[model samples]
Target: MNIEFTLNGSVQKVTITSVERALDVLARQCGIKSLSGTCFEGQCGNCLVLFDGKPVYSCLMPAFMLRDHRIETTEYFTKTREYSLLYSELTKEGRSLCSSCHSGIMLMGMVLVRSAPTPTRDEIFRTLSNVHCDSISPDDFADAVLKTIQHLTTARKIP
Candidate 1:
């Protein structure tokens, strides 16, 4: 079947089989390079993408589900101010994530901070818990997310 969707601000049409997943279609058919995964089970968030501005595990999403939807890969997101802000806060904590997890974490952070500029620590942790990674301590990750939220709050208050 042929499906059309907006990918990284461009409309694209790709053919997909019933068994094909969005992760594969994005990379193989649509030439999206920012998504990759070790697990196709969605346990690892390495295949994360923004589906209509929300982070989703592409590995588990059927290709047909992407029809008429908007998809944003990490590469596209890297150009956004939200990505820069999240990346800066994460780096300020002095820990570096693997490339895959870094993308997932940053995307998740953007969603969290945008949806709730003043999220509680527990809420932040809960949102971040979706990405399975061991590079940073949970408490440390929470701290970084909190800092990102704080930064956004401060910026919004200015002017």
Candidate 2:
């Protein structure tokens, strides 16, 4: 089967079996270094990628399911202004996300903030629960995400 999609702003066409996972195609065939299938069962969220502008676990996504979809990986995500601002907030939080979880966490945080005008703490916490990293406390992570939302949505930063 041939799967056609836009990957990181480029149109990509790959011949893969219907059973092939999107995660394998990304790292092996497409050379995406930021995402990988750590826990092939889709529990870890390490293989997170935006499919058609929505966050999804690539480990469980079939290659045949990608026709006309738009995939966003950290390769393109890191270059965005949102990433620049979020990275700054993440740095100030003093808790570093391991490489495997960074992209997933960033995507999750961005999605939550963008999905609503003002997401409650419980909503942010609920979405962030998928983030399994232990280096940062949940409160701090939520705070950082909320702060980023404030900064992006308003001209003023939260003090």
The deviation in Å at residue 150 for candidate 1 is 2.1
Which pairs of residues have clashing backbones in candidate 2? none
Q: Write the per-residue lDDT of candidate 1 for residues 31-86, one digit (tens) a residue.
A: 77767877888788889998999778999998999999998877776777667877
Please, what are the lDDT tens digits per residue for candidate 2 over residues 54-120? 7788988887777788998767767666677777777684657777788788887767656767778
Model 1 worst lDDT run, 10 consecutive residues: 110-119
Q: State the displacement of the C-alpha of residue 110, model 1, in Å, after optimal TM-score superposition.
A: 1.2
Q: Candidate 2: misplaced stretches above 4 Å?
A: 156-159
Model 1 Cα displacement at 143 (Å)?
A: 1.9
- Summing lDDT over every window of 10 consecutive residues in candidate 2, give the lowest-scoring window: 150-159
Predicted structure with the largest lDDT when compared to the true one = 1
TM-score of each: 0.88, 0.87
C-alpha-based local distance difference test score of model 1: 0.81
RMSD of 1: 1.9
